[model samples]
Target: MSTWNRTGPVVVEVDGSAEYLRIVDYASAEALRCGAELVLVAPYSAHASVSPMMPGYSPKAPAERADDALRAAVAHVRHRDGYATELAAVAGEGSRVRVLAHAARKARMLVVGRSRSRGPQRLMHAHTNLTLASRAGCPVVVVPASWKPCLMDRKVAVGIDGTALSAEALEFAFGTAAGREGDLTVVHAGLPAEHAWNDEDPDHSWISRADHLLSETLAPWTGRFPNVRVTRFLSSRQPAAALVHESSEVGLVVVGSHTGALPVDPVARRSVAAMTCPVAIVPHHVTATDHERISAAPRRPARRAGRSDVLTP
Candidate 1:
């Protein structure tokens, strides 16, 4: 069970890599905008069976080293941003996916950096991003290492499948667009007609049905976010390809991952890896009971502007 409460901090994984630093910058800016604390987590795992007969086989040394690295990385980022009070650091011992996934249970969102490799190389080592996106308690945002902050056309793109998962993604996309005062583009990809039909052809009923479905899916959200400029893109291509192409022009792409559909759908996996900008994977259903518990918990006071704190796990 995972809570989808907004009271939790935004968690970002930091490994002191160049890609991780870029992630830090993006995550920091996002945290400030959302008025949420930024948590940097560094996860490490030690090799098993270090024989005492060998020189200096201390079991606690690996954990201490990981903690030191995490502390340094956090301090560096905090100093660079001059946002000491808005940040916290945590050091955990385990595999990266396991540790970060655990942290995400109490986070508003989890942010991570993607590798520069593309095509086959990228696919070969995309398990980390896929796992986090599919299994995290909250939404997971994956940003490319080469992405930098700059002036650009601001728009949020969401893929709509007319499913409950897609509805949740629509809510997130609409809220994000409203918060940023950006444009919202809802894309629905439908299969092509088996035979060409003219405008007046009576056999074009399927096309009309697809159009109606798109409209019905977006009707409520358009009213909810009246201020957000909305654009509808109905494409004949596959959903993954259409969204991947749309990702090039938007600041963020929002996609839905069913609760148990991971490593099973090749299209979903490919879309996440192909996106040029940050990709946000929103789950269909988070635990309602967990949300209640989190909402009922006591709230902590805001930290003073100059204070800095580090948490260990």
Candidate 2:
């Protein structure tokens, strides 16, 4: 679990792309809802990207591009009644992942935009987001590039793996559902290969075990978020596929990612790429119990000032 204070600012990336305004809108609303400051950061490279054919043409410097992005983002936020939330914009000089991770080091959460790329591009994009989430030390909300406000935005879903790994994710899901004043759906997906079952028996032990796990994992959160209606779904499909299916019906999907020096898990990578709705990747520390539950071995351990500094103004 993240040790940073949840009351910190809500940091968001401002890339000045087609989807940037929408991302800013989402971040602004989250900051307003949480009563925290909304921070906009634009990361730029040191050098300019000049094309060979455009050698005679002078393209804007990276610093200038970053400033422009931040300016536009600030205007967009203010235009949407974001005056109530404290706002700050920073133009940082570095890689996107580095700057964003630094900016959100102590943030309540980091909000970023997901590209609409497919195939290898999609996988690479998802990998970058997951990398940022792992290093961010806070939850990372990856909003779909095509996302727009709708009635379904009120519904939220979370995937639990029937272990302590999902503990922090459950907390975030319940809180988000309560905040939206919507329903929460808990999905637990188990593959047949992972479980042993009798072909003749109609009642599989895995089903009962999954049910108990969901109930036990959700007990405290359910009591805390009484107003958020909860629904349980146990599926035999792949974990990532199950969450992606749920994403179509909900506004947000929350899933946990193990934090360590190892590579990002396939489940999180696939779900984030495939989900149609916004996905929140909550990073939690992998515990000994998690290893025992999954029969896995232990793993090794493992943003955002503008111009190398984080400016408030």
Candidate 3:
């Protein structure tokens, strides 16, 4: 049966790299937090087209090799953490990206391990991570290999663009922060205002506009999640750079994919290459209906554009 019919597990991709075991650890913790099952999938490519008369052919089957790897990964997880959550192992066929993307269709989230590589090697790895983040039905959390198990920072950072998609990112960020009892930082980056008056004091006027937009965007979520502490950050840097800088201090960074409208390659590449924390790429499609419903509600009074007041929730 297709795993898609069920909806209780957090799927993780495990491979040859020992770093993947760390991914299992993070995914397990996330599964525990969500009260869901953890599934470890090891995907192997089948080389059926290879000629049998090759000079250096091995007799062992590809499925057998894949099964062995999957079993070892499961054993490693059991040895390290003695994880208590319900777990399963599957030896899937096809590319790792394809298998994981298929599994994510019914999962709470798809977790994958990323390691630092250079040049074309880096691009290859990024292609897989990017594919998963952009195509997965659920959120994709790309955890860096260098991440260590430490005391939770209790902070979640999210990038906001004042778009409907950003609202989805905010919802995920708020839920994550609330669950972890963490503070949420909403970062918005944009160019200076076009008007000369506002341009002279962009920090005052431009920042105020960004703050108002963020507040208005988060107003409904603030009501829904009354306990989540939120702080607003305004920057003139590029979105990717701003979020990446914020990622350094935050436990987790959340971003919206905007139904694939927003380019995720830059963040995905940087996250794998150097991010200190796991990055959650939450696509906006899943929350589109909710956004529409919220939009149909009574509108709030439009806040004045040039107020120096900061937004607090």
How many residue pairs clash in each candidate at the backbone level?
A: 0, 11, 0
Supply candidate 1's per-residue lDDT for 79: 79
Tens digits of lDDT, candidate 2, 19-133: 6788888988899888889999999999887889877999888899889889888888887784787999999898999999999989989999988789879988988988898
For model 3, residues 130-174, the per-residue Cα lDDT tens digits are 557667767788888777766555899887766655655677788
Worst 10 residues of 2 by lDDT: 304-313
lDDT of 1 by residue, 6-49 (tens): 45888988875655687887888778778889888888777645
Top-TM-score candidate index: 2
Which pairs in model 1 have colliding backbones? none
Q: Residue 11 error for model 3, in Å?
A: 0.6
Q: Rank the models by lDDT, top first.
A: 2, 1, 3
Query: Which runs of model 1 end up more than 4 angstroms from their true locations?
Result: 1-7, 48-62, 193-206, 261-263, 286-313
lDDT of each: 0.71, 0.80, 0.69
Angstrom error of the Cα, residue 252, model 1: value is 0.8
Best by lDDT: 2
TM-score of each: 0.79, 0.87, 0.78
